[model samples]
Target: MKVLLFFGLLAIALADNTRFEGEKVFRVKPVLDEHVTLIKDLAKSIEVDFWSPENAEQVTAGTDVDIRVPAIYLDLVYTMLQQSEMEHEVLIEDVQRAVDGQADTGPSPRAHSYTKYNTWSVIESWIDSIASSNANLVSKQSIGNTYEGRTMTILKLGKKSSSSKPAIFLDCGIHAREWISPAFCQWFVNEALTTYGSDAQMTSLLDQMDVFVLPVFNVDGYHYTHTNNRMWRKTRSRKSGSSCIGADPNRNFDAGWCTLGASSNPCSDTYCGATPESEIEVKNVANFIRKNKSVIKAYLTIHSYSQLLLFPYSYTYDLAATHNELMSIAEGASSALRSLYGTRYTSGPGATTIYPAAGGSDDWAYDLGVKYSFTFELRDTGRYGFLLPESQIKPTCEETMLAVKYIAAYVQKNLY
Candidate 1:
């Protein structure tokens, strides 16, 4: 039995290794109509993975576009760029080298470290341990199962109260490749537990409100990223008739239902599900939020590769009803975050700040009456992209903690 178990774990470890040998990431500065059209045309011509500005549709004049090109297309991409007269630079030369350099060392069975990017199994174990260890202030709840049958666990953090307290629903890793997102969630949980008594603000917030932390929102996709592909970004559900494996959970919400900045085609990275909440993972979360609507005063979803603090209404160009207030809080949080390590985060409604991404969780949460809903795009704007180094985990989480605490402090004080 022990021998069998050992072999099983070995197989899992071997499968988790992903190598991206000769791939290159490029940053293109599209400054004209022709440049933007070229980017769109290039995407259609080949499998160009847009890292920044999200999709080819968002590739507008004067915007910086980041894209990952396969080894086979590198020469073609370079030649086309030269002919088109578009200004561009290589951000990453050898993706596998970057991936190898991202981590400090080879994998070891050391106890889970918040500063390290743990595998899904390690995170799962850490979740169990942390929740069990801090039972008084943190309790675990399995909201549902992922498409691949992994349990979706949420940790509720706060002092136990006689009655239900107004809460904040915080989730991370909605897009699997954004590893730093889940790291922040875990860090937030640790901070809330470790600082409760000594930190007056944290104590007061806990005394007054609850925080629900879904450490990894898209469990299946996240696991897949660790096991199969380092850049996989959607849920891991297979459609009966389609070959596509997943839907973009972030783009699977019901706010605007795939109208803008999203694709109906299953093969797209930003493919909205066949319908809103079509992904079981999204449905489970939406159902939980809907059931707890009366108490969930704020919704915070974390993503990465752009340093932005965004609020609702990404589905349309129209501003959110609480746009000004949301902007103020986001700016304040951004400022707080900047004070630590000088990281600057642009703050505004999602549509104007970034692009018109429909069916986002923040938008759906806001429309569901969670007025303080916000989405955080964390870490370096594009240097690392989704493959942010593990060494950065500490500082990233440290700075983000300030912004999150700022939001939590504001939510606590403003709760009616």
Candidate 2:
């Protein structure tokens, strides 16, 4: 029996070891400060799944680069960068070989099923099933049409009141490669429904506040992620006479529109778009938020693999008008999240947290007087990045619940 069990486990491991075997790691150091921008501009050659400054205090020897990227095009990407004579070394060979050896080995393990890179259809089906079972699901009339005409879905959870209720608007999957973002949205819905009557805080909060979640903010980019490259970020809008496709939807928001941290080049990752809200997906959400700005006291835009909790003023280094209050709330939420598993997450302004990004939804939301606007960068710091394993989903969602509830509870209590 032990022999049989051993073989069974071996088979499962073998089946789940479908990682990037042909890929190679590049331990690169920047010759110029704009080296990252150059590589990002040529993202087609060498793909970067994760990129960050090795700012962690706990640094290992030969790990100063401090980025973990998992992709099939690593070798080709390395070749392209090598041509540029960038100083680099191979940090870790066969990283995923170590990954599967350490990751979850249980029944229905995420490293197993989710490794297949499940499509939007699979996730959409799950959303449909959950919404059908829950009574509080209220979808808005489609705010606008996408470039491809996929109907953008916005779900409002909690029971409807006879009168208006202060709302919290949440959106995710603005950048396509961040698949984990959309998963959190779905998880948030499931929790809200499953815990409605079971959890008092959730019940009372939902009873008072309407939570509007647009599971996938960039529907076209999301669809592109499922169909094409796994690391594709930005929208999927095609510009006339320009070969480049898509704009950074975050850079297309109305506030500060695209004054800084944005690109005039259409192919750039931070292209501000032809105009503010040019991308229909951004337009849709912007219009929806505009129409309901009065009630949206708290706004959250979810992204992944950074382990960050960021608030507004990303376009510039300027502190928000309600900086003190926003900082207080963010600190409390981050502290609550860490209490669970000691999961490490940094809390700060968006510009300081990662990079200064213009036209982001958080900034726009805050400018619109949704002063409690925030952005949650979810899951493992770099181990998984955007390709975070499914097994980690529950834990990520579970720990995140504390922070979310902390914010939700605070918002509900402060309501006039």
Candidate 3:
């Protein structure tokens, strides 16, 4: 009896250490009326990482939800979802494994692999290296300081395009838990440097347009995720008269405030702040966009797990004046992305395609008159949630590069 009890306790401890919750992303196609309510209920019961028309058609028609799951519980959830009668497809089942930064791979290199799986300190050094190497092409500016006093840096890639050339703004890792988000930012920079001369499209882009890249918007939250909890999302700034430690910066934008699909409870993941731009980081980015409104024609923000391409109207799912044009461009980008590896990506407006999320960066950019705003949810459809492995960094970014270039080319041709 004593031996059996000991084994039972050991088993319990092991299971608890593997206590991973699935970020189950579903490619859910809904039957318009029946599907809308179903998706909502599923979101209520299980967390929906992302939702948009790009990935799913409106509930009035067939729509698929791209679901993501954390590493530990992926198998369990995937098997369960597979057995369910719902018409769901699992696009990618790659798992993001969590390992020590100093895992015994070999002797440490001379310098940190700052562009990959890096902390804020490493990232700062990496940026400094790039700037020092390419004095003419790269210039850095401190937009402002985050709550923790870390500088919010922005890289102005390429000369500001002609007043009529149309500019695109790219920001990533707004949510700290999505490490892969920042990875793409660094990958973008590497690609730009490596292929600038040989890649015709890239070369043309460099000559014609200005790309503003904010590698990580929520620096404090990102740092916290690395040192403390792995799943920490949102900014680290505390609100007055409340004990909640952070606010969902994405949901704290000024566009629609927090009307639908946002939580007021500070503890909730989707908590919107007391007011729009409540977080200093958001204000800094917003201010930059506002200051550059005439030239900043497009805004592209990246997040992870869900393979989605979304446009404006996150506050509400209704179509925009340029909805037809934006939707058409998104479709083109999706097709380009698919060409690389038959990777399937959905494109559509925010409200009709996914849950109503107010205060999204894309929507705010659109409201600020940056009409070509978009949000790309990158990498695995779900098996490994936020722990996307370092191995996938190359292919994921490469495939995404096609879509970005395609969009840039399209914008160039149609720039008015």
Candidate 4:
């Protein structure tokens, strides 16, 4: 009876995983109004997954849209694309194949390695161990719990000081499936601790300013992506009377809450929560920032597969109050990042650079008087999209480190 029960549990676990066997990711370039309309129509008619623009509504003329279409809809999508004569190419011929190839092929190790995409369980253990390993440079505090009861802790990195020191809050993995985001956060923490005394600039920055790193912000959704669906991108909170599980935590912030570039539908990929700060994860971070508003000088949020550095005013086209300074700083940081491996990064405001994404953490942070708020879209232009290989993790994180250090040094110098 016990053997039968064990096999039954194993079957249930295997059944819960969502697989993508023959799904294809396509990059559609719509240069005309009709082409844009056709893309939107395809989304409305079929179960198309928008990969880049976040949703079908954000598709516009002169912008490249990346979407994943299931095997059943392949013939229809091909017909529509050929009929419209829209410029399109298949980025991934087989999504499952790409997903399988993203990770290294080896027995999973118990220890955490910065170059590999670590699971939530592995990351949680690493957080506790890393914080305790270096008491002087690192200390952690749980801000709150995620919707699925995962503890959200922020690792504070800096030299011990007598009085309260100014801080810069950096968070990663807010979108869950962007595995590289959390990887970069882990790399940043490791780099800071490992090169403290040897690297002059790092030593100076840590001596003066505290850098708070949230390795994985959307803990629940991140865990779901690993165990159930590899493409899951939102929280895992269940709402009454609605089958949709989670909201876009990035869009659940209070700034310009759901005004533009966000969907009111609970089923959307960019669903703004029922109300601002609805997701416990967002509220937990928001409350912490509000409590330390005076000392937090800059906010940096990491994301993937765009290779862009964006600043405030994603909710609207209007330029930020400190637009000139922000642009200059972003340009310099981009240059520093490019110096490492010639990885070019376009730096500009979020709305103008990419698309109008309302209620983003960067925009919210800037509005809350954290003048130096910025969002990073790291690695490839779209060749791999979110399925960036584990092999590129080292170079990606190394180049990004230069850009982040550039921003930190500037913030430290300008602090009043």
Candidate 5:
């Protein structure tokens, strides 16, 4: 009886983790209309997961589309690619191998490390401890609870002041699978606290402006990725009649909600939710921002797997009112980031720089008077995609810190 119970528990544990055994990630360069059509057709036919560009509809000529094909459809996909003669290469030969190899070897330390991918519980504990330790520099407040009942806390980093300070709202891990996004947020917090008095630029930014850091925005979805599916991108909310779980928190915002580059189908990775602010997580952040819109001069949201620093108007092709200045600031920030490791990052409006991803938090924030809104797609373009290795975390975060500080400084200088 005891042996049976032990084996039963082991089986349950193994069953919870969704393994990507022979799945392959391919970077297909769609140069012609035919190539784009072919790619779209393949998505309609099989369960092709778009790693970059987010979905099939966003695939266009001259852009390299990275997709993950299931093991079962590998032969079919290969045949189609060969017949079409589309330029393509395998980014990840086996996703399971990449997942296994992404993390550092040996057991992870019990304590959270900035250089490693920490789970939600670990991050939560770290948030509490860090805020407590750095009482003068950081104070945490629970904005709200996620759909899964996880407390969504934002750490306000600045010296305590008698009068309210102008602020920048920075959030990471809007998309659950982007572990590096949240990692960078943690790094930013650590860097801000540890280098407060010593780092002149950081000290000035913190002293003058309060920066609200939501380390992991989609807390429930992030927790799901660590415990169950490493590739889960949406929230874990369930509808009554539908079996599909979660909506893309990034696409659930009110700005051009459910328009281009988003899907109405709940099962889609980029599902825009039933309505704007449908997902409780999105609502939580949106509500918090709305309440503090007066003092929140800038908004920055972090995402990963595509090295691009994008500004507003993702919902439309129209130029932002402050386009020229935004572009100049982005260019400077990109230059600052590149100085560290020579990791190139393209800078421009979100729609033109990448695909038009409507309902993005940055676009929503921009329309709500946060003129300095920006979204960061960090790390190697597509080599590793969502499964970036632990080895690159330190370098990625270190360089990203420069760009973020550059933006904060710009916002600080321009505040009237």
Candidate 6:
């Protein structure tokens, strides 16, 4: 028993040591043409990790670029930025401190709460309980399994009907470190169940359309974040002949596979994988979406840190077929979201609004005939980034709820 206990304690110690002690996240704004090349050169010289925009390749003039640098390179990075005359600021002075400060220190909990960042186990249990408690409005389906054999459960929320109803598909946490993404999904479930009859918009939404919520899209990576690394951001899949263990599930779709804004290197954060649908998690979600393409009208995939509501064609500069209508709806949704907290969100086509990210699920969904497809990048511009505090969870989710409801209501009305 003592031997077993010692090994268990050693495991916990190793996990806790994964925290970023001396790492700092810097936000730099490039003004001159040489500044971009300077940032690229910095990445090539050292292990500079791009936090926002996901890659150094997306760093451009007029946009704030956030990158986390190792302790040893902090002085060198600051000197380089000064010499290059690039404007920069430290967003997070200590990354480990920010990571540690994300969770609530109030008290121990027996059950999951919407305001807290719950672990994969807590979330799984909450799903079962919530679906059981709200039997008529919520039911779960095991769509498929992750690469690590963890079950991928999607919760279907709607009023039971004799016949099938048009549905909207919403998924969150496709990239694992964005804890707020999954939190919003769980909060959405809570709001839907708690305000089913009282909230007029929600009631009408359930009455007209079924909403499928995949609360945690990247199960394996999410679990890894809680157990091993707080910043793990890909599906935990091991491929033969590669030292790396995961692929960017967001970039694993068939739409413009391995194109711009994605990496062919297996070790990259935005690694597109061996081929389209290379990750089992992506393949599973794709298969489910394909299976229910007839009834699924809208696809909303939630992400974080950048305040943007984007539509399809992220793979290319080409505008989506339904560009005008999608842009109008996105602007409306952004307006609704901003009304709550005065939090502004830019609305436009993903490629033009941001950078060209190929193989994104929204692009693929739009190509698959899901006309009303969108991707939501939620909360604070760059102050918090991925390490958003737990206190902001309620406000963020509450405001996001408005935008999601607005979209759902619109989709229901325009279901013709």
Output the number of the lDDT-best candidate.
4
lDDT of 5 by residue, 1-416 (tens): 12222222322111233889999999989898988888887776557788988999999999999998778777777777777788899999999999988887544746799889998988999999999999998999998898889999999999999999999999999999999999999999999999999999999998999999999999989998888899999999998888888999989999999998999999899999999999999999999999999999999999997899999889899999999999999999999999999999999999988989889999999999999999999998888989999999999999999999999999999999
Score each candidate by Cα lDDT: 0.88, 0.71, 0.72, 0.91, 0.90, 0.89
lDDT of 3 by residue, 224-302 (tens): 8877766678799887788668999999998788777677877556788878898999999998889889888788899
lDDT of 4 by residue, 195-244 (tens): 99999999999999999999999999999888889999999988998977
lDDT of 1 by residue, 22-102 (tens): 989999998989888777877776677789877888778988999988776676777777777789999998888887787
Worst 10-residue lDDT window, candidate 5: 5-14
Sorting all predicted structures by lDDT, with the top scorer first, yields 4, 5, 6, 1, 3, 2
How well does each candidate superpose onto the true structure, as a TM-score?
Answer: 0.95, 0.79, 0.78, 0.95, 0.95, 0.94
Q: What C-alpha lDDT, on a 0 to 100 scale, does residue 239 get in candidate 4?
A: 91
lDDT of 2 by residue, 208-310 (tens): 8899988778877887765565446888889998988899898898878777677767866668899998898888888899899889889999987679999
In candidate 6, position 290 carries an lDDT of 98
For residues 1-416, could you state the per-residue lDDT of candidate 6 as single tens digits? 12222222222111223668898999999987788877776665566678887898888888889998777667677767767777889999999999888876663345688889998989999999999999999999998999889999999999999998999999999999999999999999999989999989999999889999999999999999988988889999998999778999989999999989999989788999999998999989999999999999999999997999999989999998889999999999999998998999999999989899999999999999999999999987888899999999999999999999889988998999
Q: What is the TM-score (0 to 1) of candidate 3?
A: 0.78
Give the higher-TM-score candidate: 4 or 6: 4
Model 2 gets an lDDT of 0.71
